[model samples]
Target: MRLKISLKGAVQGVGFRPFVFRLATELGLKGWVINDSSGVEIEVEGEEKALQKFLLRLNAEKPPLAHIYSQDVEYLMDVGYATFEIRESRGEGRKEVLVLPDIATCEECLRELFDPKDRRYLYPFINCTNCGPRFTIIEKLPYDRPHTTMKTFEMCPICKEEYKNPANRRFHAQPNACPVCGPWVSLYTSEGILKADRDKALKLVAKALKDGLIVAVKGIGGFHLMCDATNEEAVRLLRERKRRSEKPFAVMFRDLEQVSVYAEPTELERALLLSPERPIVLVRKRRDLASSVAPGLKRIGAFLPYSPLHHIILRSVDFPVVATSGNLSDEPIVKDNAEAIQKLSSFAHMILLHNRDIKRRCDDSVVKVIGGVPVPIRRSRGYAPMPAKLPFKLSRKVLALGGMLKNTFAIGFEDTVIISQHIGDVENLETLRSFEEMVFDLMELYEFEPELVVCDLHPRYETTRWGEVFAQSRGIPLIKLQHHYTHILSCMAERGLKERVLGVAWDGTGYGEDGTLWGGEFMVCDYRGYDRVFYIKPFRLIGGERAVKEPRRVALSLLFEMYGKSASDLNNETVRSFTQDELKNLYIAWSKGINSPYSSSVGRLFDAVASLIGIRQKLSYEGQGAMILEDLYDPLVKDHYAFALEDKHIDWRPMFYELLEDREKEKVPSRFINTLAKMCLEVVLRIGVEKVCLSGGVMQNDPLVSKIREFLEKENFKVYTHQKVPPNDGGLSLGQAVYASL
Candidate 1:
């Protein structure tokens, strides 16, 4: 009997072809395995029993990194062949093949790195079929060496032998190389003058890191500015030079044990840290470290070394080290050696350069455990370029340009949607350039020409403007989606849901259909369109965008709403912090409605409460006040303050008054948060929807989400939140793509 089989999904660049070759040869089968534009293809000519056994073991004994999304098999005519072989890849077909995300250095490759007897020992570019750069190195398709940056490096006889031998682990590895023939590493000062090369360069880079200097080390995806996490001066210097204030930096530990010493990782978080993706996991801080590392945050973003070079550096250092993206604020990560030297010289003391070129700029992914599941906060690196399977197919290609903050874009064709790796805010010129490059790169890789372009409804967003330009240039139609509606749709798309859902979206700000800002929203939505059913009580933003940076302005606005301009004279901490002149000006602005925009934003409410409770008067980043509010939560406080629902509006003024009265007696951030959760539950019940979807950046708050989910589920409602994608604007593009498909 003869059979032909087709396997799709993450089968390319994961040793799938080699695994099939070995399996067929061991079973005494005459067959061939090859990769095509769609996926992996295998043909076997053997006995019926052997074919059955092969089929069973195919999935059971496949490579660890291979993920089978679908498979098809059919009987074929028996054409006798001598032995099984791995054939060259076929490039002509619909380009539906899954591109593997960059993988961390496997245990076998790590052993080879440190083994003195190994030929590739201490080679920075060492990788095998099972691990190392995949998406970041490949410029085009078929997942072959010729299509990657590795095309420049000619493999030596020893490496060529390993590539052709199916019995070898490096068989058909696109990046297979050795110290004699592969890409080499070099060390240089920030000024681009070479200091050392190869093994000596690696040693010197490690020594520089140990001596408390910021070293810009090139890694799998992009360059990382690294320094000892325990060195206060080094951490402070990097922060100063990078212009990053208050936002926590992700620290790389030597291993899981060292991570546990600083952050209390749950079992799931530990697994996430050790997974092949090796994303930075947010966990509760367990011990004190450099004060400048995370500042006042209660949690730290931590991860283990993902590459051999990272492992070597971390192993050399006794303490954790800050491994942050090597770009300045609001810019894309540095990918090219020349660009790194030119742009990052002011921030980095030395440069660790490599010859392996980075084709894509992917930042490290970030996740946090919520309700015992790891939820993506920033989905990139190890989880990008992989398409999300849509429930329905698209008639034509669609392009989705995400929102202004925490931006990510997507391209959709047929039943697959490939969302780009997290692109930071596109407001900056450099980031916008990176965004345009990514759009062109993805189109080239997937052979896609979009028929329609989609964007947020906000006309002022840089991404929105870019989408309009792209659509006009292509002579295609442009679709605009309301920001909160897209947030809910993103969650719905991940779940493949088509029915109407009661979606509660709570974020900092989004452009609403009514020409105002909407954040706290209740909507009845399906794929085609949505009906805004309810929203938070409208409040005046005292200083427009200035209120976002200063939470005290929001507090004053809320106070003026309840007590008039005389409210500014109240003896509250937030009120007293302002000068009498500043207070008078703010009160006049709120009372006269000058420079004040009305908003129904739950995020501003959190910021207001945070300021009224003396938690944070100013915010350095979006959602900083909310995050601090969550951290200050006390689970034991079960009582909630008062709130009211009038006509379709959820009024929080009563709650604010209660908080002001209880400020001295029962003052706690937890009580305020619990009240908000209960208020959401009340709205959910009033909406009377069995299927509820909670989304938006505020939903990233673990305790708040857990509380809302717990309350809703207890009432027999099916609660849906984000897991595969972020609840924040990072996941907005997926929603736009799916909405356009509908």
Candidate 2:
């Protein structure tokens, strides 16, 4: 008997063909396996029992990196005369093969890097079929070396032999190379002066970091601005140079044990840190290193080295290192070596660069353990270009332009929605160019031409304007989706929920259907549409966009709502932070509605409380005030303030009054957060929806999200939160794509 099988979904660049060939040979089958534009294709001729065993093990014992979405098998007449073999990949087909995200250095490669006896010992670019740069190096489809950065580097005779041997780990590995022929590292001064080459370059770079000098190190995804994490002056200098005042920099530890010494990681967080994806895990800070590294935050983002070069650098240095994305604030990460030299030279003392080029710029992914599960905060690097399977198929390809902050776009065709890696904020020209470039690259790679474009309804959003222009240029329909509605749909799409769900969408700001800004909302919705059933009482954002940067403005607005102009004279800490003229101007703005936009955002509410409690008066970044508020939360306090619902609108003024009264007695931010959770429960209970979906940027608050989930589950309401995609705007594109398909 002969069998032909087609396997799809994340089966490319993951050693799938090698696994198939190995399985066929073990079963004593005679045929071949090949990779085409669609996916992996295999044909085997063998005994009935052997074929059965082969099929069972193919699914059961396949490569750890391979993710088979669907499989089809057909019987054929025996025509094979030769033994099983791995064939050359074919490129002609409708390209549907999922591109594997960049995988971290596997254990096998790490062993070889440390072992002096190994031929590839101390090789900074050591990689095999199971691990190495994939999505970042590939330029186009079929994932061949000719279409990658590795095309310039010719493999040595030893590597060529390994590439030919199916039993070898480097079999058909596109980036396979040895120290003799592969790319090498070089160290240069900030002014482009060469200092050292190869292994000596790495050693010098490590020494520079130890001496409190910042270095720009090239990795699989992009360049990372690195400095010793323990060096307070170095961290402070990096922060000053990057202009990232309070945002926590992700630290790279040598291994799990080293990470454990600084941050308290649970089993799930430890696994995420060590996973092939190698995302930065947010964990409780166990020890204090540099006060400037994280500032007011109680949790630190930490991860182990993902590449051989990173491992080598960490090994050379005893302490953890601050490995931040190599870019200025709100700009795209630096990918090109020359680009890094041009942009980072002013800040970094040295440049540790490699010859391998990065085709796509991917930032480090961020995950936090929420509700005992690792939830993605920013999905990039080792988890991009991999499609998120849709519950329903689409007849036409669709494009989704994500939100303004933490932007990520999506392209959907048939049953798959491929989300772009993190595109950063689309507010500036550099990030906007990155957004357009990645959109074109993904479409070109997937051969997708969208029939429709979907984007947030905010008319002023740069992304929305781009979508409008794109749709108009292509003569396609543009679908304007409400921002919070998409947040709900994004969570629902990931969970495969088609029915109407009670959605609690809480974020900083989004354009509402009525033209006001919305962030806190309770809606009954599905993919097709949503009904805004309830929301928090609308509040004015004094000074409009300025209110976002200065939470004192938001606090003043909340106070005005409660006590009118007299509110500014409350003699609170927030009031003291502002000058008399500023306070008077804020009051006039609230009273006269000058540059004041009305918003019902739960995120703004948190910011207001943060300001009221004197935790943070201004934000250096979006959600900074809220993050500080969460850090100040008193875990022992379980009490909540009072709130009232009027005509389905939640009035938090009562809660604010109670908070003000309690402020004199105790400064507990947790009580305010708990009251918000209680208020959500109150709304859900009133709405009488059994299925609830919680989403939005505010959902990134682990303690608040956990509290809401716990309260809802106790009421027997089936609560669903984002797990596969982020609950923030980073996952908004998936929701837009899924909603457009429906």
Candidate 3:
């Protein structure tokens, strides 16, 4: 009997071909197996019983790293093949294979890395078919070595032998290399002068970090600015050099045990830290080390070593190290050696250089456990480039340009949508150019071009303008989606829902359908359309965009709306911080709405409460105010503040009046978050919907979402929160792409 089989999904770059070759050869089957753009294809002829067993175990005994989304078998006439061979990959196909994200070093490779008898021992680039750079090193499809950055170096005789052996772990590994032929790391001064190379260089890096000096170490995706995490001076110096204040930094530990010493990780969080995709898990802080690590927040971003170099450096030091992206503030991570030297030298005392070329720049992913489930905050690095399977097939290729803040783009075709890794804010030309290049890079990799383009409705967004220009240049149809609606759609897309859902979309700001800023929103929506049912009462951003950075201004605007000019007499920190004359000028701006814009943003409400409670007055990051407000939550206090629900508006004026007069300020954050959650439930009850979707940036708040889920689930409503993509603007493009597909 003869049969041909086709396997789709993450079948490439995961030893699928070798696994097939070994299985066929062991079963005395003849023919060949090869990788193509579409996925893995195999042909084999053997006894009927053997073939049946092969079919059964094909998926059961496949490689651990491989995922089979769909598999098809076709009967074929016997070709009288005598031997089984692993044939060369084919470049021609529809390119339906899912591209995998870069993975962490496997246990087998880690065992070999430290074994002195092993030939590749102490090799920083040690990787097998199960691990190493995938999305970042591969320049094209077919998952062959020639298509990867490793093509620059030819394999030596010893390594070449391993590549041909089907039983070997390194068989057909795209990045298979050793000290003799693979890429090597070198240590250089900030001036770009080389000092040491290979193992000695890594040892020196450990010493530098131990001595409280900052070193930029190149990793799988990009360079990470690293310093001793326990050294307060080093942490302070990093904050000073990067001009980054208040925002937290991710720390890298040697292993999970080391991570447990600093932060408390749940069982699921531990699994996430130890998963193949080793993302930074936001765990609750336990023992205190450095004051400036996370500053005001109770949680710390902690992750284990993902690469052999990380393993070696971390194993050398007793303390953990701060490993944040090596880039200027509000820019993409630095990938190139020359680029790192030029932009990162101002902050890093030393730079670690490597010859491996990174085809894409991906930052570390961040995940937090909310409601006993892992929710993505920033989806990049180990979690990106892996596509989402759409519920429905699309008519044509679609391009989705995400919002201006936390920008990411998406490409959709057939039933697949690939969301680009986080591309930072498209605020400056440099970031905008990076965003454009990455957008095209993914398209080129998939061999796809858009027939239609979708973008946010905001006209001022660079992504919107870019999408318009691209659409015009290609003569493609273009569509614009409301920002908050796109957020709900992203969550809907994750669940592959087709029916109507009550969406609770709350964020800091987004361009609304009515030309005003919308954040706190309630809509009965489906894929086809939506009806806006309720929204938070509108308030003003006192100084336009400037109010985003100053929580005090947001509080002033909310106060003015509630009490007019006499509101300045309140005894809150925000009111008392300003003099009578300064308050008078601000009141004039707020009352007359000089440069202020009316917004119904729930994120600003969090900021206002933070300012009123004297917790946070300014923000250095996008979610600083909300995060701190979440930190202040007292779950012991179960009561909620009052709010007046008008016909279509959820007025917060009564809540503020109660907050201003209440002397129990410690319980305000809890009551505030509880009230917002209650308001959503109130609106949902009024709408009379069975299924609900919670999305938007404000939904990233753990305490807030937890309470909302508790309230809704108690009513037996099917509440759906983000499980795959993020709830913030980072996930906007995925929503837009899925919307276009429907």
Candidate 4:
């Protein structure tokens, strides 16, 4: 009997080919197994019973990361092959090959770490085919050891044997290494390079934690700010040092069992915890952990230690650790040692250094529970560079600038669209540099020189600037797509929707095609074209740039729109923040239409509502006002705050007046947010869009997301949201990448 099999999903990086080679040889089967662009293909010749047994074992047992989505087996009558041979890979276009992110250390490596008899015991870098770095270390395609960062470090005699042995787990493992030949960890205290041993280094880190000192530790992908999770004082001290207020910190647990005390884990969550992709999972808090760990938050973000280094650190520490990006607020993760020393010095007293060179910086991914499933908040680190299959293929290679905030870059070659790890806001120079470096690195790795580039139409966006520069330098044709159109395209790509869609692009703000700020918009769109079907009534941005940071300015904009005169003319000093002259200039700008672009942005509306209800006057972060505003209402129970919907437009003036009425009465609750969410969702449903695609940075608001999704379901309309990618700009590259393909 001769059998032909096709295997799919995450077979690349993992030792699937070699595993098959050994398995076929062991079973005395005759045939060949080769890797194609689509997936691994195998043909085996053997006795009928033996072949059946091999198929059963293959399905029952597979490499950790290799997910066999489907296995199609066909019996062949012809047997032209001799003994089973491991054939070379077939690299072709239009084939679906799984691209996996760099994985954490696996259990086999962990066992060797603690084994005193093993040469790799206590080694910081111990990896085999089962686990270790993949995407981060690869310098070129075909994913062989010679084409990776590991090429610089030659394998020892023992390692060489393991690499060549078909039966060994380390066979063809691109990043296979031990402490003897791999990266090493060092302790840097105030004196620098402390003479302490590895164990003492761990102890010193623990002592620093006990003393309420922050430590910056470098991980496989990037640096992390760490402190004792059980100590409220330590957590609070670190929070103050990092300037993070109220945003929840991700806690790294030693194991799944340790997490149960704080939050319950479902079977899917348990499997995700144990899976190679050790992403941070958000779960409801049990009220035992200190509130300071997640200030003003009901739920907690938790993750199990994915690497051996994390496990070793957890062993020395007493509680769940607060591990966050090692950067000042809104900046990219610090990758270089010198940058970590300079930027993190203010907050960190000591640094656990690593000799491994991190060519790129990837922030820890954040995930949250929504509709009884994990939705990625920030997509990076554990899951990136993996190509999401597109329904249509591109005509030429292209590069895309995602968005400004939570920025990420994307590269597309043939059928594969590779999105870079989370790049921070492009507003900062450091983040911009990281984005450029990663883009260069990925292009070189894939041997792709983009023939085209794409960016948002926004002229002020740093992403647009970078894209313009790169396109000019490389002489690549550039495509400037509408921001909201790209947002709709993203939803379309995710759902594999190739035809026209009722595109609902509601966000904080986007540069409209007609030289205006557009956010809340409904479009009838397809891959080639789209038209703005409906939009919210436009209003002035009172202080322009100042309005984004100060929600009070937006409140004044709404007030002036409702009242005949500017809010500043009312003699309220609070309103006097904008002088009568300043108010006159603003009104002139609105009247003459100099810089004021009419926007129906739902995000700015949320900000205005938040400030009107006194939820937040000054926003410390981008979505702070909207998040706090959403927190004020519960959609579970009935609430009566209603907004008049006229045709396809939402009349926000009534809601503004209602807020003024409530302010005069001095009453507010979470129901206000719930009412607005219900009203907005109701209007969307009334427009008769069968599928409501929720997007934008504002969609990061969980409370509003919950209310809207529930209400849309009740209205018998299908609601779609970003799950494989983030709802924020961190996921913008994916949309941009797909759009470039189109």
Candidate 5:
């Protein structure tokens, strides 16, 4: 029997070709395997029994790194081929190959990295087919070395032999290189004066870290500005330079044990840290090694070294490093050496440069364990380019531009949607340029010419406007997605939920259909459309967008709604956040609705509660107040506050009154979360949707989400939360794409 098989998935950059070659030889099959835009195609002739075994073990005993998402086999007449061979990849086709995400340094590579006798020992660029850079280094489709950033580096003799050997692990590894031929690292002064190169560069970086000097070190995806995590002065200096004041910096530990000593990680968190993805995992802070690292927060973002370069650096350092993106606050991470020297030198005393060019700018991915369930917060780095295999195939090629904050645009064709890596907020020109570059990069990679473009309904959003121009210029249909609805749909799309679901979309701000900010939303929705069935009672953002920075304004607005003029008279922490004059002017503004946009956002409610309770009255970063409150959650406090759910409206006035009467501010976090859970139960029961989807930025709140999931699941409601994608605006692109397809 002869079989012509077509396989599609994360099979290209991975050791799939080599695995197939070896498999065919072992089966005594006469065949050839070749790569294509859609993935691998193979033709094999063998005995019927051997052919059956080949099919079984093809996936069963396939390469550990390879994933076969879809495989199609056709019986063929024997061509009398004498030998099995690996042929050159084919590029002419509808490109559907799943671009593999960058993998962290595997245990085997790490072992070889430190081994003194190994040829690649102490080599910073050590990698095999099982691990190292992928999506970050690739330039185009077929995922061949010639089509990657590694194309310039001619392979050394030993590496060429290893790369061509089907039996070797480095076989067909796109980024495969030895120290003699691969990219080399260099240490430079802020003025671009070269101080050292290669191993010496890493050693100098380690020394700089130990000596409390910040060093901008290049890594797999992009540069990471690192400092000793235990050094308060170093961390403080980094914070000052990066202008990232309150947002917690992700700490890179030497190993799992060191991470355990700093942050309390559950078993699953430990697994995530050790996983090939190597995402920064948010876990409880067991010991505040550097008090300034995560001020006031009980949890910290922690991760292990993902690359051999990072491993070598960590081995040399006495203390774990504070690793944050190599960019100023809110800007895209610096990628190229010139960009690092130009922009990053302002933040670092020394720059650890590398010759390898990053084809895409990807920030570190983030995940947090909520009630023992790992929820991806930011999907980037080792988690991007590898798309979500859609439950339903699209009729036409589509583009979905995500919302403003934590922006990520996506492209969809067939049954797959490849959401771009975290593009950061697209408000600024640099980040917007990054977004634009990535959009075209994906389009060019897939030969995609979208039949439709999808964006949020917010008219003022940069991405929405960009999408509008793109659609108009290309003469394609444009579809605007609702912000919160897509948050729900993102989760639904990821979960393959096409049925009507009670979507609980709670975020800080999203443009409502009525032209107001809608954050706290409950919609009965599916892929096609949504009905705003129930929502939190509208409240004024007294200073408009300014309310987002100052939670006190939101609290003030809520108080004024309940107590009228007497809200100013109530002498408390929240009221005292403003002087009598400021209070009076803000109240007047609230009363007149001057520059005060109304919002039904649960995110604002969290901020209001955070301000009212004095946990945090102002924020330096998005979700700072709520994140602080998450730490204050007392599981011992089983009690909850009071609220009114009446006629498609959630009235928090009752809860505020109860909250004000209660003096135990510590109980506020858990109680408020419980109340929200009960509120969700009330609405879901009323709306009568058995399947519930939790989404939006507020869904990132561990305490609140855990409570909601717990309460809903106990009622036998099939509650769904984001697993493959984030619930925040970062994951909204997936939903927009899903909506476009439906």
Candidate 6:
């Protein structure tokens, strides 16, 4: 008997084919396994018993990274195969496997590393078929060694033998390496003496942590600012040095036990911690480890090591360690040694260095529980470059230059949209250059050449600048996509929506085509286009950019608008912070139209309400006030807040005014958040669009999203949200690419 098997999903580059070949051979069966553009395929011609055994094992034991959605088998009469063989990559069919992100050292590799008799004992870079680098090391597709960063390191004799042997655990492991012939570790202070002794170097790092010293450690993807998680003094110092105030810090623990002490982990949470991606997951806090870890927040973001270096460090410490991105407030994580030394000089007391060159810079991915599912916060490292299946393939190749903040570009052709790793806001020169470089690298790897380019309608965005420059150089057509449209389209593309749905884009700000600030918008649209169906009433931001950080200013501005013209009286306490001269300039700028533009963003509304309720007064970070306010919403309350439907638009003035009344009446914070959530739901459903897609940076507010979801489900409406790409502008380019194609 002869049978052909098709394996789907994340079965590629994970040793799936090699495992199948070994299993078939062990079963005394003759078969061939090959990879294609879609997934893995196998053909077997052998005894019935052997074939049955192979099938049983194949279903039961797939690779750790391979997730088979379905496996189809077809039987054919005796088309004899003499022996088992592994065939070459066949790109003829849609059988592409899901390529996984790099994983930390596995149990088998760890055992080998610690074994006194093993050749790879104490090898810091030890890896095998079951674990090691994947996304971070690869320079191109097909995921072979020649296309990876490991190509520079010629395999030692033992490793070469293991790689060639089909029966070996290291068979065809592209990143297979040992300490003897792999990347080496080093430690250096600001004065610059490279310490080659790994044990001594790690000890120095640990000692620094113990002494309340901040150290910048070069991680698998990029640099991480490390400190003792338990020490409040050290945490406070880190917060001050990094200029991160009040925002929760993500902690890395040795194991799940350490995580359990800080937060409650469900079965899904446990699986996420152990998953190869090993992303930072936000969970409900069990108790405060220290006041500084996540000051004023009810939840904590925690993760486990996804690299061998990380494992060793965690093992050495035997406790949770704070491992946040090693960059100042808005910048991207530093990737180069010289850059790290220069940029982190002020932030770190010492640097645990290494000679291994990092060709790619990736940040740790973040996720949070929303309705019992992992929602991607910042998609990078473990989850980037890996294409999201578009609802429909593109008609022409296109490049999408995303918005200004949390910038990430996308290149799409045929069925795949390769979103670049998180390239921070392209506002500054260095960030713009980084964006260009990251784009060039990804394009080279994918061999992507664009016939057209898409950019934000905003003329001031650095992304738009690059798009214009590149378009002029290439003489390609450039399409200017509206910001909110992209937000809606991104959700549609992610959920594989075939038709138009209600798109709600509520955020801080976006440059509207009509030369005004946009953020609060309701649109009826698809990938091709959208019509602004509804919006909040426009209001002036008292001091322009100053209003974004200071919620009090936003609250005062909204109150002025809501309470009619006289509410702008300078003597009012709401507007008391600004000086007379400053107030005069702001009023003139807003009233006579100098620098201010009217905005109707829901995010601004949240900021205003949060400030009015005294939930958050001074903004220490971007979205800090809103994030903390969101963290305060208690789901135990079951009351509905009121919002009225008028002229096909859901009016928000009523809710804000009501909240102001409640505040005057001294209502609880939980009641305020619950009421606001109720109002948002009423507004969403009032539009009469049952299929609602919620997105925007502000949607990352878990409390708001969770409550809205609950209300929508109760109303028997299907609510669509961002499960793949982030709801923020980091996810904008993918949506832009999708819309541009349409």
Q: In terms of lDDT, which candidate is strongest?
A: 3
Off by over 4 Å in 4: 1-9, 32-61, 67-82, 85-99, 111-121, 152-161, 179-181, 236-248, 260-275, 288-292, 413-415, 566-597, 663-670, 676-686, 740-742
User: Which residue ranges in model 2 land beyond 4 Å of their true spot?
Assistant: 663-667
For model 5, how does the per-residue alpha-carbon lDDT over 1-742 read when each residue is reduced to its tens digit? 7999999898887888888899999889998999999899999998999999999999899888788889999997898999999999888888888888999998899999999999999898999999989988888898999999999999999999999999998999888898889999999999999999988888788788889999999998889999888989889988888888878999999999888878788889899999989999988888887888999888889999999988999999878998999988878888898989999889999999889899988899999876557888999988898789888898888899999999888998888899999888989998888899989998988888999999999999999989989999999999988898889889888999878999999989999999999988999998788899999999999988889999999999999999998999997779988998998899889999999999998889989999988877889998888888788888778878889988878999999999888888778788888899889988887888899999988888887877888888888999888888888899989998888466
Residue runs of model 1 more than 4 Å from their true location after superposition? 664-667, 740-742
- For model 1, what is the error of residue 7's alpha carbon versus the real structure, in angstroms, after optimal superposition? 2.2
Instruction: Please give the lDDT score at residue 583 for candidate 3.
Output: 92
lDDT of 6 by residue, 1-742 (tens): 9988887666766778789888888888886988776677899888888888888888789787676755899999876678999987765433245556767678888787768899776666788877877777777656678767788888889889988787888888887877777776778886565754676887777777777788898887889998889889889988989888788899998899889988898888888888777899888789887689988777788899877788777877755889999888777788778888888878888887766667688898888766666788888877876777776779988999888898889988776677877877777877787788888887776566899899899988888988999999999999988888888888889888878788878788988877788897888887668878777777887667888888877877766667654545634345665566765566566666555567877778778867776666568767877777666666665654456667745566676666656533233345655655675566666667778898898788876777778878888878898998889888898888887455
Candidate 1 vs candidate 4: which has greater TM-score?
1
Deviating ranges (above 4 Å) for candidate 5: none
Candidate 5 weakest lDDT stretch, 10 residues: 368-377
If scored against the real structure, what TM-score would every candidate get?
Answer: 0.98, 0.99, 0.99, 0.87, 0.99, 0.90
- Scored by Cα lDDT, where does model 3 land? 0.90
lDDT string for model 4 (1-742, tens) is 8999988656877889787887788888989988776678899988888899889888777786776755789998856677788787766643455556878788888988888999988777788888887766665556677666678788888888888777888887877777667766777863455645465776777788777778899887878999877878888888888888767788888787788888777777777666677888776666557668876555677888777788888866667788888888877788787777777878888988876667667777777656555677777877886666677787787888888877777887665577788777788787777778877887766556888898888998988988899999988798888888888877777777776667667788888988878887778777787877667777877556777877776766777778846455664423655566867776666556565556677788877766765566777677776765544455444554657767656677776566556533233445555665666576666567676677776666677677777888887878777777776666667677777356
Tell me how far the alpha carbon of residue 550 in candidate 6 is from the true structure, in angstroms, after superposition: 1.9
lDDT of 5 at 437: 90
lDDT of each: 0.89, 0.89, 0.90, 0.74, 0.89, 0.78
Over 4 Å off, model 3: none
Q: Whose TM-score is higher: candidate 1's or candidate 6's? A: 1
Give the per-residue lDDT digits (tens) of candidate 2, residues 419-446. 9998888998888899999999999998
Candidate 3 collision pairs: none
The stretch of ten residues in a row with the least summed lDDT in candidate 6 is 663-672
**lDDT (Cα, 0-100) at 608 in candidate 4:** 74
